[model samples]
Target: MTDDVVSALLHPIYVRLQETAVPAGGAGSEYILFFSYTDGRNRARVETFRGPTFADAWHRGLARLRKVVAKHPDMIRWLRVDTVDEMRRSNWAELKRQLTEVKRNYCRQGISLDRNCRHAFLETEINANAMFYGGVEYPHCVVNEKNFRLYAKLRHGLGDVDLKDATLVWMFSSRGFFLDKERPDEVHEIAGPGRSAGCRIVEALDDDLLSKVIKSSSTFLTGQVGDDGRFIYGWHPCFDREIQAYNSLRHASTTYAMIEAWEVTQDAALWAAIERSLAWLLREAICTVTLPDGTEAAFLVDVGNEIKLGANAVAILAFTQHAVVGGCIDHLPLLEKLAQGVLHMQQSKDGSFVHVLNYPDLTVKEAFRTIYYEGEAAFGLMRLYSLTGDERWLSAVEKAFDHFIAKEHWRHNDHWLSYCVNELTRYRPQERYLRFGIENVRDHLDFVLNRITTFPTLLELMMASEAMLARIEAMPDMRHLLGEIDLSKFHRALHFRARYLLNGYFWPELAMFYAKPQRIVGSFFIRHHAFRVRIDDVEHYLSGMVAYRSKLIGNSNRVRKAEATV
Candidate 1:
């Protein structure tokens, strides 16, 4: 059998064997046994067996095959036994040469996987022009090939028994078994076309295998950020070692993981890490390099800083909330200081926050960027007011709300609006605030009923609806505001919220409002409708709201009680 014929059948199976051995910790040992068979006509079949325990796995496979052959007489004729040891002795050196050729042609150059050749497997060459956009760089790092080669050489030098056994098995299989059952002439004829097609197929297979390995590893690692500022995503070590940091991507992911950790464990260590991260952001990330004109230039280091307000707000809120909830309320003064900076940077004259800020200096050059910023800043300021009872903080919220109202921007079905409304209800629980919130709630509900169709959008609508329902029920007279809402649609929205949105830390607040009794204490004929949610889940939701308020406003019982009711 020709070397080409042996490779065509055994290589894929060999690769798969290595893949299957990847362990839970991403470190493991793999064993592959290749066997070759040949007919007198120079036809060959190459069969590869692989596993952690090769002997046992091979024996089990052989037993299964014997039973299958026993059932069919003609099958035994097709499976002719040849001299395995003789074939191995005859082809050992030739097989080694073929293996080296395979490594050089496929592994070194990378393999193409399709007719179009758009996709490839295992790139080693660097794209010199790929920009270093963000984060710290590690200079003069060695390439992945050098590292892998060193690892292989180290294994060889150690005279590792497993490595010797694996190599022997690989060489034996390449020459001893004609598993492919293709004639040498046939293989040579097909090699040209097959190599072209196989390159693409192999490339796709490599990508899929690499992706699976990465996803599995990430799950096992709990998305940990490495020292390089990148979460390990794939099986292959990054080819461009200098650019491996993943800088902004890793920061965002780590930020998310920290938030989740705080929500679950409330662990002090997690809080410390969060604070360190925030310090990293403030000191290293948000740049303040000045221009020659004595004008400041701010450069927020990440992409989210360039486009989205939600991520930034969440990062800030996570730190601020942790400071309050962790009883380090002493941090409130520092938080207030930061809040003032954010306020000056985020707030606009219309009482709205700018959507995007062009930094070193804060400048609003885009309108769409302001939408999420307004919603997020409103929520943040509301928390500040709730925490501190600072009229300045409340004043900031009022200005933001006034801008929101003047712009009449709450008509859309948006999660940002939902968050804003929830914050508004918490900070300002007067009849006017309740009335305004209820109207927006109705509008939001209408938008959902009319426009939202997907499951995810529906879930968001339900959460927003639940928040509004809670607010309405807290008021002394909320029945009038409920007039236009269809009971069936309301229940549908409620059920969806109960099923999906009501869970973890936010559930009790949602439940208390949904389960509480509403009492109407005003004239049903009044044109100006007022709504309220009775302070039933006050203990849990209020604690959170109080902590949020205490940080924002100042520690005061009246604002605390209002927060509880809202």
Candidate 2:
């Protein structure tokens, strides 16, 4: 029965059994069993299983193979486990029959050919003739054949090679992988399953896993709240310790995450941490200014005594959230003063606001020159309007969003705009804002479908959350009140979120081709990033998960209530 079950699950990429004897042909001799598999390209991945005894290594190797085959079924037919040094004790006839069936199934998926996943990468590299460098807008360390392909592999990860003999060396990224003309075959450890760890994928965000990781990642923030209410700004994931780095923006953003977490879990400790952070904000981070223009405002400043528009905006979000949850009106005075700052600072007609102010003196320390702050400011103003019912805050959103649209600033990183638009659609029912939200988020459709990054970044996830909420507002969730928001492209972004959270997981049980072992779980790293954990990375993922969970719960309840009526 066990054999039948295993046979049923076997794919073309299934692992082959081996029965190799001890290497020394003497008692107590140990060995490391290695097998090489290629994806019909020049590249090959050699997975190793080293143990004190041949029997142990073989057993461990087989177990690893089972895991690899489970995650990647396409690599089965190309597996080459029959090493010359090994003794053949496995049943080949049954294995051959299994391969035949698996191949037939794989053919339907168009993966029956031995053509590996790396074939496109290898072919593109071999045919490359021109290499262009030295452009200011080169788009992230690229030689620009539409993103770099491997030229040669670098085994040591840095700095042993002579620069005089180098054919291709990127000093910026410290990447020194150039093939020698004479020694083409003698390249670095670049070809294999391990090399692709840089291209780690994201599985769909699981709610259960999300709950566990949110609790864990937030521990890094809440556990270390200072006796004075300051957050430990940065953490070195490699060493698992705190590093001396501080950003008021990251501090405020993290506080917002804690408040959001508290809303769901109702964790008393988390609430305490929020209060601690609030104390830090009020005592040290914030400044109240009454200018000669007779406009009084509250500004959140950094250590250098400069205030950014976005920080104040997020502070409002944090404070507003805290106020709503705690029923604390003490922060409301500061919140209104902060909203006044946003109101006074926005550029006339252009609708843009200055990035930084010297505070109290009310001088523009830094000109309003960046994009993200506009959306943040607009969203903050909209939130205040939501709580206050003051039409002026809503009026501020309308003015800033108009300037944002005219300047075409809504094209990128527009999650804040989407949230603002979503609120306005609820409050005022404007078609243009709704259209802009959908169109802006729709641009993210390709990122989802292509799995561009292994997982979405916080900004990306926030965009998806807005798109998803807009989706609910448009169709099933709020179809009665308003017509559909025309979410054909925005829908793809949500689909990508589902794909990413589901497909992006890299479990430790899977067979690893890299020599170094890694304890990488609950890490939704982007594509082309190294495998290292960060507090914000998990928090951002949780933000998306929390948003999706709310959507799912709403959907389920709607269905249940509909059925009850039926």
Candidate 3:
């Protein structure tokens, strides 16, 4: 089955390159064909073939591939092919200049230069002469026809070679291939089965496929929870090195994501894992404090003798989700205690909250930490409100919003804020809150659309905003606020971000390039950060995907119902 899956992904590359083998300019063109091979049991071998003619180079590479396949038939599990015509350099220099300008523009805008999920940005920058870089953008690298050797060497570590003649590079392996050339009208990309790394293919995001991705990813995450009821933290993946540090906030957030997934899959094993992880959090992280008012509150404390607002917030989220999904209220009292801890962190003067506090004694550790804690705390309160219908939770979130709006918190464009707004507006839906929700995602669409890393939180923000927008659009009175909003652009950003995220997903083919394919293949990775696969990384991706899938199914169901009524 694995062999067939791998071959099905590879065969298309062979056929597409065969069809485009000879450039339109035809004869007198120099062809450079490069192949990287691995059979899962051996170190990868990189081979390059060059000939004065396209047929000559292609046949040489093909012959070598055939020989390897014949010898290691069952073992030949991965192959990557890159073919380019040295003579197809029309406009290549101009395109190189434009690519440089794009990099400059990104720097000027303070945009990150990581190329993990920037295929769309590249396509726009070069007028379609672009491909996914799968790593940071190298200052020494240029994808122009004359610098294929430099491009290949820097990206794949394919040895220091001196070849300066190739344009229109067509690269493919397990996740399909795309061509980066000077002509927007002639750009071609083929998506493999399941997910397309760079190609604009929507079929891969179908419901059944997304469900499978969710299941597999959740299973990977659940498996990370040890018998001791704590997560293994994360991995660097490239060298199989474990990240030595752990965070209470991430543990709780990851647990929240797992419970969110369990809401979809209802797998018993996943539930057991969630129980163990929650137990670990309760046993080690939580501490109860006696308030000056003679009441007690429970705070989740990490390794340091500190209490982070986000840690307490996410713990509330995890416990609330566990209770809501498991159809049990056994955690209700604990959740209320956690909520009290969050309330204690808030400064009653201006509705702002302290970020961190020294544990046990409960003095402020730092007045501020990150922008995430405020929204996360508010979101956790909203979740608790949904479960208990407690007015205090709702009122606390509203008070936070007053500060968020007065300070124009929409500028941060945070996913947690989006989550909080979506949850808040469901009951409140006041004009100020509605505008805040819309403005949260309004101006940030282009940046979100063009961002390089999969940066999973952007999707979460978009999806949450999308939900808020759909609700607003349905209300007759509030519909006028959306007049200034380009609904199409907002929807496009959501769609593009959802699809572009696949570039960071470690589909088996791309995963083969790393040290341990089996361990990391199914999880989402941030290529810019040493291909890091941590619990929070997978959690954000899983949560966004689950929300996306829900949106898709919801749309499909609405359409079907509308058609039936018609």
Q: Which candidate achieves the best TM-score against the true structure?
A: 3
Give the whole-model CA lDDT for all candidates, comma-separated. Answer: 0.37, 0.52, 0.71
Question: Cα RMSD (Å) per model?
Answer: 21.9, 13.9, 7.9
Measured on C-alpha atoms, candidate 3 has an lDDT of: 0.71
Residue 75, candidate 1: alpha-carbon lDDT: 31
RMSD of 1: 21.9
State the lDDT at 270 in candidate 3.
93
- The clash count of every prediction, one per candidate, is 50, 18, 1
Q: List the candidates' TM-scores in order.
A: 0.43, 0.63, 0.78
Q: Regarding TM-score, does 1 or 2 come out ahead?
A: 2
- Candidate numbers sorted by TM-score from highest down: 3, 2, 1
- How well is each residue in 346-441 modelled by candidate 1, as lDDT tens digits? 446677555555543445546465455566566666666666778876677777777777777655444446555666676566555555555555
lDDT of 3 by residue, 1-566 (tens): 24344344455566676665543222434454556556544434556565766567666766776666666665455555544322222233444454454432121110001111111011111211122222355532244432334434544454543222333322112222432112212223534322233233445688987887789889989889999789988887655678889988899999999998987888899999999999999898898998889778999998888899999999999999988888888888899899999999998878899999998889888999999999999999999999899999999899999899999999999999999999999999899999998888889989888886678999999999999999988999999989867899999999899888877676554455455656776788765465678999999999999999999999999999999999
Per-residue lDDT value at 40 in model 2: 29
